[model samples]
Target: MPSVNAPGLKRRKNRDGTERLYWAAPKSALAAGFPNRIVRLHFSAHDPAQHPLIEAACKRLEAEALEWTAGRRETRSAFDGTIASLVRQYQTDMASPYREVKWNTQRTYDQVLGVIEKAFGKRSLAALGISDFRRWYDEAKKPKAPGGSERVRKAHGIISMMRRMFAYGVTAELQECGRLLTILEKARFKQPGRRRQKLESHHVEAFIAKALDAGRQSLALGTALQFETTMRQRDVIGEWEPIPVAESAGGIVLGARRWVRGLTWADISDAFVVMKVTTKTGSEVAHDLTLCPLVMDLLARVPADRRIGPLIVDETAGRPYAEHAYAREWRLVARAAGIPDSVWNMDARAGGISEADDAGADLDAIRSAAGHSQASTTVRYVRGTIGKSRKVAELRKAHRNKS
Candidate 1:
């Protein structure tokens, strides 16, 4: 048997007159028990000269493996048993799951992680108890927004991540350790009141007028287009080049790659207009919207120059506005327009649908325009009767008299 000078490699002779290679962690690495530094290797019984490339490649691989093993061992040993080391490991291993989530979602998790690290930094994971979690939760729940409900949603999001991490630890390395289920149960969030407050047509009109009057033409166009389209804030203001008017059928069409998920530009012909979108629920449907004179006029007002790339861009950055930034600006615009700050900006889309229905648009037509998978979803956006209730009542009365 030959022992290689490479710190982690050991060669052993097999009973069948063959040789095998194994990665033996350094004595310090074995003592520390960090999985990353552990490596193992096996080689087939072949004459080394017959596969000169394979022999050379194996030597190169072994050298690189030894380098990685030593580096990780040294790094882990420096941190010893500190919280910082555990967090670095956890973040490295667990970070991928959060990557594809929306920017707003990632921001929420980051904020939550910060609070958790601040409160529990010195404590060992096994020692975190129900009372410690409760103290954090109680402190988190005290601040209220203007509508007066506690703004502890951020805290709850953090606790949820901690719970997931603890669960992963239990499954991956700590089965014998006591679980944090009891602590997590106490910290779970209760459902707050319905958060989606619909804005009125008057409010929408006022917002546009104020933005336009303030010489904020781009903002006015962005606000109006988003309201009319019912697109997600990100989709509405993303780095998508709008379908050219010559190509579009007198209606706004977005490149399928820009708005729709799970489909590529190559999947459909460039000539195909995007009439439907697949939502997160896996339903494929098109948004229904009327090319109302008002909507047409709003689109017409957008300068051809500003329409060069994305329909909406951040006024300051000249880049696509992230959803949260758009939401914040939406609130500011609503407040400036004399609308209640409590009103949810998302309601503007619903308000537009309702207004169209009031003007005698068909239910099915509205559904198609809004890209709702079900007509019922479109109905939810219909805030009030839209005079349909009165018209139905009048028809019922006339039918009763005729009978």
Candidate 2:
């Protein structure tokens, strides 16, 4: 038998002496979302007759890999009218809702889009029906473990992304997508329950104590800042975004990661007032740290030399923690403080909003404090705690007695 001339081909031998073949894609093929970095060539390894087929398959896959690497996959002849194509169109189309979202939000949408493409990329959009989607939903909603909680949120997110994609297809005048959207409108799915957990003062104190003890002063201060200011975690922790093609003049670049501005010392006035433009709403919000003793005390403890850059710097990286890293570190500290996993770093803002409601602050004031453009948006985060209800009851009784 002669050696085959197929590149990237590997053969593994079994105990029974039969061999299995695989084509390993180059590392760069990851940009194309290549599965497990390899494609199985279903040919008998001992058969010389299979060599030509194996070589052909390898060449074709390699060409596709190169096409993806050059970023020309969308423009290539392979742009069939599949859900995958729709995903590509929805993502790149400037008028699509995907483009309207903030950078952090787009990142999440990309993850769900990847899931869509991987699962249904080859499936024809015209053939899809409510039954197919229901089956997909069932598969997506399954628990990761045998008895673990169902992934209701994950399932809902996938369906939401699919709906958005189909809606975009309708905007683009795709007949199949419009039909799918119409069919989906009548379909029923289980909705995830709204999260009511809020980080309370005790959780904040415990987190701060744990963070400080762990030598994570920045994490401690960041927590206090978010809780006191009622700012989103993204606004407090900041985020790394890709440098756009247009211009690269602004934003701090560390290695390949471009840092969007988070809460910086420059944003804080000498009088301990924070004036910041939030990432989500782009709303400028001002808060007096002097009124928040925890924030002020934490600020005072920071030496002048270290207070020059971003307000919350990861001690380990000497810069802002990536969103995942921040969440992970926060979870560790929160767990150390005996805070339940249900309460998240994001809940700090909710906790602050709820605290404001409990403190007898007007709805308008709470909304303003939250930097929300609408009272309805602020209302979502404000949990009706026992303290707020008790205050309302006391006020009602006092008014009755006076009457």
- C-alpha TM-score for every candidate: 0.57, 0.76
Per-residue accuracy of model 1 over 320-378 as CA lDDT, tens digit each: 55436767876777788898866776666777677777777888878766667789988
| Prediction 2 global C-alpha lDDT | 0.82
Root-mean-square deviation per candidate: 13.0, 14.3
Q: Largest TM-score belongs to which candidate? A: 2
Assess candidate 1 and give its TM-score to the true structure: 0.57
Q: Where does candidate 2 have its weakest 10-residue lDDT segment?
A: 72-81
lDDT of each residue in 127-147, candidate 2, tens digit only: 789999999999999999999
Pull out the clashing pairs in model 2. Answer: none
Per-candidate clash tally? 9, 0
Candidate 2 structure, TM-score to reference = 0.76
